[model samples]
Target chain A: NAGVTQTPKFRVLKTGQSMTLLCAQDMNHEYMYWYRQDPGMGLRLIHYSVGEGTTAKGEVPDGYNVSRLKKQNFLLGLESAAPSQTSVYFCATRQGGAKNIQYFGAGTRLSVL
Target chain B: QQQVKQSPQSLIVQKGGIPIINCAYENTAFDYFPWYQQFPGKGPALLIAIRPDVSEKKEGRFTISFNKSAKQFSLHIMDSQPGDSATYFCAAENSGGGADGLTFGKGTHLIIQP
Candidate 1:
């Protein structure tokens, strides 16, 4: 089964351009998160959704927006991309229970010039 | 402010050697700590994890040593091999607040030399 899948494996955008990253999970998890990984910066949370139709801000949610309109899909949107937004973005999901393990997707590499 | 701090931005070790990565957190509410391994062009995967109540937990060649008093924890890879080279991350979550998300460290890039 495909655990977590992220679309647009790679992308390049000019400054002020807009784009959307999609994350899909087949594990029927209740929580989904968006994070960006940078050199020496690890992975910082961008936004998250607890369940369908619910979203919340994360550590680095300034330049991004997210929607969880469906149970299996979470979308992260970049209204106006910036150079600083260039990084490898990851999508993760976790089953709601006592176990706190998070499953991640391959990742999406975005470069904003 | 960074809630979790990881040391040694990069490390290199010979084959069959032991490579250790350390992480410390400031939040006492954090009860769950986990380590993730990531290969090039892949997402980070859970390596091993530990709770504050346990002093150590071992799985295969991976081990997690937790020191609750010091708010510190570490990952020790025994018999390291070239295939083990990857970026490792330490993360913490406050389960008390519900599993909202995790606070991740800056990450440790490890290279195992053959």
Candidate 2:
């Protein structure tokens, strides 16, 4: 079903470089989220979109931005990548309703040098 | 701050032993609790979940024991195998559902020795 797909499985970025990670879901879900996973930190929310054209900041949204121009896609952008920003990024989506189970993508590994 | 707190940052057990990972949350509004398992390079996948109304939920060898009053919950893996070695995370969400995203605990690295 390809529930959620993330592009650029791995990438290396020099400090101050900008990049965007793409996330696409075919489930027609109403909610999408971006999260980063780091050692001993688990997963921290970067940003999220409740629906098309709507976005909100999460716990750790300081250096990241997100766009959800379309219902099936959510993009995470790093304005200026930093060494501390290096981590594994994950995209997730959940079907709207009473159900809250979130499905996740494989993940994108980012290394900022 | 860290809304959800998980214990035993890492654990090691025999192949057939049982490993339990616990998590406690301060948010009283949180009504849903879930456990996710992730391998070395993969995203976290839902393992099992429980609601406040239920104290326990079981799926095969994995089970979730929830304590609504204490705002604590745990994941128990029975008859663990070496293949079960991976990182586990406990998360919670209020009635806000998916749009609110999930508050996760640090995570537990489990290693089932062969």
Candidate 3:
């Protein structure tokens, strides 16, 4: 069974371009998280959800938005991409009945030039 | 200030040697410490994790040593292999409280040379 999968493995956008990254998990997990990884910065939370139809702002929520319309899918969107937003994005999920072990997607590398 | 601080921005070690990466956090509420491994163009995967209650936990060649009083934790990779050449990240989180999202460190790049 597939754990977590992110679409658009690679992307390059203009300064004002917009795009959405999709993440899906088949483990029926309740918690979903979106994170961005920079060169030196390990990983920063962009957004997260405790359950479906609920979302919360994370440490680095600016310039990014997320939605958990379904239990197994989470979408991260950049309304108007900025050069500073260029980085690799990751999505993770934690099982419902665990202390906290996150399963991660491969990743989506985005570049805004 | 960073919620979680990781040291040794980069490290190089020989095969079969031990590579230790350290991390410290400011908040005592953080009871869960987890380490992740990331290869180029891949997402960070959970290598191993430990709770503050336990002093240490080991799985295979990866081990996590945690010191609760010091609010510090470390990851020790015994018998380090070239296949382990990748970036290691330490993250902190509260299992029962806090923001719920993970707080990560700056990360340490570990290179295992043959």
Candidate 4:
């Protein structure tokens, strides 16, 4: 299985631009998460999905909207990109609960002008 | 917004030396703790993990030392090698099957020189 994979390995965007970052997992995991990692800062959760069709806000969710139309896909969208959003974004998924281990995707680097 | 706190933002070690990274959490509900290792231009991979029920867990050259009462945990790399050089992160998740989603530490940059 591919485990977890994120699309658009890298992107450059201007202010007020809208784009979507896609995350997919083949593990059939019930939990999926999106996080952004900035230099000197650890990954911060942006949005998460507990299951297909259910989404929750995380520590850093502003300016981002998420949709989990299918269990295998979780999408992160930026309505109006900002410079502050320039960072490395990673997507992860876990089987379920604390006992289940989490798997990660390579990551996508985004630049918001 | 961080729930888990980690220290020693960076470290340098010689080959065969032992490197330790520490982390602590404020949420008492956290029961599951795990460590992730990341390399340049790569995703963070699961290195090792432990639960509050146990004080320590080891796998090969990597070990996880946990203290439930202390609300702290640490990752130790024995006989450090340059190949082990990377970024290490400590995380904690609460006791239930639901909140197990990790709250990660800031991360530590480890460098092992040959």
Segments in model 3 whose C-alpha atoms lie over 4 Å from true places: none
Residue A72 accuracy (lDDT) in model 1 = 98
Q: Which residue pairs show collisions in model 4? A: none
State each candidate's clash count.
Answer: 0, 0, 0, 0
lDDT of 4 by residue, B18-100 (tens): 99999989888877788999999888888998978788999999999888778889999998999999999998876574532
State what share of the real interface contacts each candidate retains.
Answer: 0.76, 0.76, 0.71, 0.56
Instruction: Give the per-residue lDDT of model 3 (tens digit) for B21-43.
Output: 99999999887899999888778
DockQ for candidate 2, please give it.
0.71
Compose the digit string of candidate 1's lDDT tens values, residues B7-93: 889999999999999999999999899999999989999999999988999999999999999999999999999999999999999
Worst 10 residues of 1 chain A by lDDT: A1-10
Tens digits of lDDT, candidate 3, A1-113 = 15999999999999998999999999888999999988787788889998899999988999988898999999999999999999989999987544488888999999999
- Identify the CAPRI category of the predicted complex in candidate 3: medium
Report the lDDT of model 1 for residue B102. 85
lDDT of 4 by residue, A5-111 (tens): 89999999999999999998888889999999987789888999989999999888999999999999999999999999999999999877544577889999999
* Interface RMSD, one decimal, each candidate: 1.8, 1.7, 2.3, 2.4
**Candidate 2 residue pairs that clash:** none
Q: Which stretches of candidate 2 lie over 4 Å from their true place?
A: B96-98
